[model samples]
Each structure stands twice: as C-alpha cells, then as structure tokens.
Target: MRMTISTHDHVLIIDDHELVGTSLMLSLRSEGLRADWRGNAGGEEGILADVRRLDPGLVLLDLDLGRDRDGRMLDGVHLVAPLIDAGWRVLVLSGSSDRVRIGGALADGALAWVPKNAPLPALLRSVRAAAQGRPVMAPERRQQLIDTYHEQTTARSELRARLDKLTQREREVLAELAQGHRAQAVAERFVVSLATVRTQIRAILVKLEVSSQLEAVALYRRASGR
Candidate 1:
C-alpha cells in the first residue's frame, strides 16, 4: 500500500490507534509522501506540543479519543478550531458514522473529511487534494454543509424579525437562555418564580417562532454566529 506524494508535503497523523497510523504512514510513503505518526490525538496540551514540534503541512486526525479525565469528546470538531486558528491544514479521518459530528467538524474549519472505509485511491486523492489546498468531502457531507449554512442564515433572519415581537421580559429571558442557562437557572438568576419563568420561556419560544428550547437556542446561536 505504499504510495508516496511529494517530499515537501510532510504529513503528520494524529490517531489513537497505532496499527492504523502505521499502515497509513507506510501507505503514504509508498506513494512518495513523507508521513509520520503520533500515538495520541494529544489531549489539549499534548496536541499543542505536537503541533509545535511537527509543524506538518497536513494533519490527518481521528476525532473519537474516548473520554479524557473531564469526560469531553476529543473528536475532530474540538481540534478544528485550534488547528484553523493556528493556520494548520487538517483532514479528518474517522470510523464514526455520525454526520452531526462530521458536520460540526467541518463547520469548525476542517479542510476535509473522509470515512476510514473509503477506497485507498479515494483516500490518496483526498490527501493530495488537501495538500494542494483543495477541499475534499463526501458528496453527502458537502451537501450537508451547504444545508447547514442555509439553515443558519434563515434562522438568523427569522430570529431578527422575531426580536421585534418580544416584550422586555421575553428578551431578557432569551438573552439568558442564549448564554447556555437552563430555564430553572435563569429563573433563579432573575429571582422570578419557576412558573413565571416557564411562562416567560413559552412566550420567548413563541416570539422566536420555535417550538422547543433547543430550537430557540439554536436560532439564537445562528443569529449570534457563535
């Protein structure tokens, strides 16, 4: 499976599985691409150290690192923001079939994503495309990204229009909810009774034209773009 790309396209693989990384490295070298492997997705701290030391032109990453001490997901989504912020090109390679996870990673700034089951030639194409600064994504995933962008745009427009329909109390409730507060917590913070908070929340939901708290929150996030 050895197929190398180019000497200049130094690649670093961040995956928890040693066998997978080894196979990938060998396959990459076979194609003339210089590839190296690391055993960890590198907890946040380790990831920083690896990035600083490797300084690779392309990074192939696996998202599911299981739970660390904090019980947080260490998937590609978490890595995307840091990698992009540091100006690194990242390609997500994972066995997971979670489209939501894939979408989140792409939204956060991954250059490409390919399922591990993809053909070797397809993987090679993605690696080369990524090295050349071209986006590589499954057709369905690409469509999902477009749909998500459109949904957010529409949600934001709706949110803005709804804001004018909200009362002062409903706006206050929405603001706190948008900050990730639960209805109960918001009730406590505002020193309002639980029933009153529930009523305000229902009003806010109506004003936002959403049926559920999650929907309202999503609309708020889309409007805020954060």
Candidate 2:
C-alpha cells in the first residue's frame, strides 16, 4: 500500500527491510492511521527529503537501516536529532539489541522503543500511543538506555584518544591485525621486515594499553564500529 500524506498527524516508518516496513505500514493503516515508510533503497538524503515532505506526527525509526547504495552504513539513529529539530517526534522500532545504540537514539529525542519482534497487538498499541505523543517505554528503562549510551560514548571517546597516539604506519598495521592478519603478513603487505612489523605491533599495544593482539583488535573494532 502507498500513501501520500502531508498532514502532521501521519506516522512514518523508516526501516531497511521492505517486508517488515510494508507490513507495519499496512497494519498501521488498518488501525485508521496514516503511515509511510522509507527504506534504504534510496540514499540518506532522499529518505530525509521524503520525511520532511510528509511531516508526520510520529516517526517509527529503525536503529539499523543496513547500508546505502554506496555501501555506506545507514543507521536511523543518525536521523533522530535531525528529525527532532525539524519538529518531528520519533519512536524507534528496530531489531537491534544494542543498548548503546538504542540509548543513543532515545537520548537524541526519540519518544520510545518498540521491538520489531513484538506481538502485533502490542506493536500496534505502542505505535498508536507514540502517535498520540505518549512514550510507550517505561521511565526507568528509558533512563537506563540513555545512561548506557552516555557511558559507552564517553569510553569510546577515551579509547579514540588513545588510538590517536599511533603513527600512520602503526595505525595501518593495527588495521591489518584487526582483520585477523598475521604480523608477518602485515609486514609483507607493507613491504617491511617482520621485525619492523613487530615494533609497530608493540607500539599499538602500548598506545592502546592492551596486553594482547586480540585485546587491541577488540578495542579497534569497538572504537571503529567494525
């Protein structure tokens, strides 16, 4: 079903999966609400443009919108503040279990969260509530999610600062290691001796304050979102 609504009372569903998005939109329509959906088939700019045009009452945003056509990751959380600033109320509806990302969206002015796997009745009710400007998420749970996001973001900043201590070559070497490449392979790829690679690896360890290559790689993945 397709809808073209310019009213502020409409609901918008921003999700990557077509089946999920379309089904949810249809369900909302069944309950006598105007709902629209934007998928990752288009670029971020296109999605936001359509959203601005719709000017919906509530946005059911997915935290993970997979990737765009250019292979760049497209997350709905990135749209939270932009939409909120434009006078839109957002309600996150996603399958992502990452509390940090969820909390980040909530902190960015989302009204509440409803799991993608939630039962149909519950999901519809939550959508209806959010469209009416009521948060479906519990207060304590909302605060907890917001706090987790802040804590994780702060820790990631500190980790990023430590990573900034690495030299250009050291950062490249760590990137290879983080991909599970052996130090020798990294040395070969960089056209350097194994000893030179070992030195770079040691520098990375010291800078990241990790005892093992695995720990350093984990930190790198966490900080870089790999």
- The best candidate by TM-score is 2
- lDDT string, candidate 2, 171-193, tens digits: 89999998889988998898999
User: Could you list the CA RMSD of all candidates, in the order they appear?
Assistant: 6.0, 3.4
Over 58-150, each residue of candidate 1 has an lDDT whose tens digit, in order, gives 888788866555767565567777876766788888887665566677777777678888887888888988887766866676778646755
Off by over 4 Å in 2: 1-8
TM accuracy, model 2: 0.91
Q: Which candidate number maximizes lDDT? A: 2
Instruction: Please estimate how well model 2 matches the true structure, expressed as its whole-model Cα lDDT.
Output: 0.85
- Candidate 1 yields a Cα-based lDDT of 0.76
Global fold similarity of model 1 (TM-score): 0.60
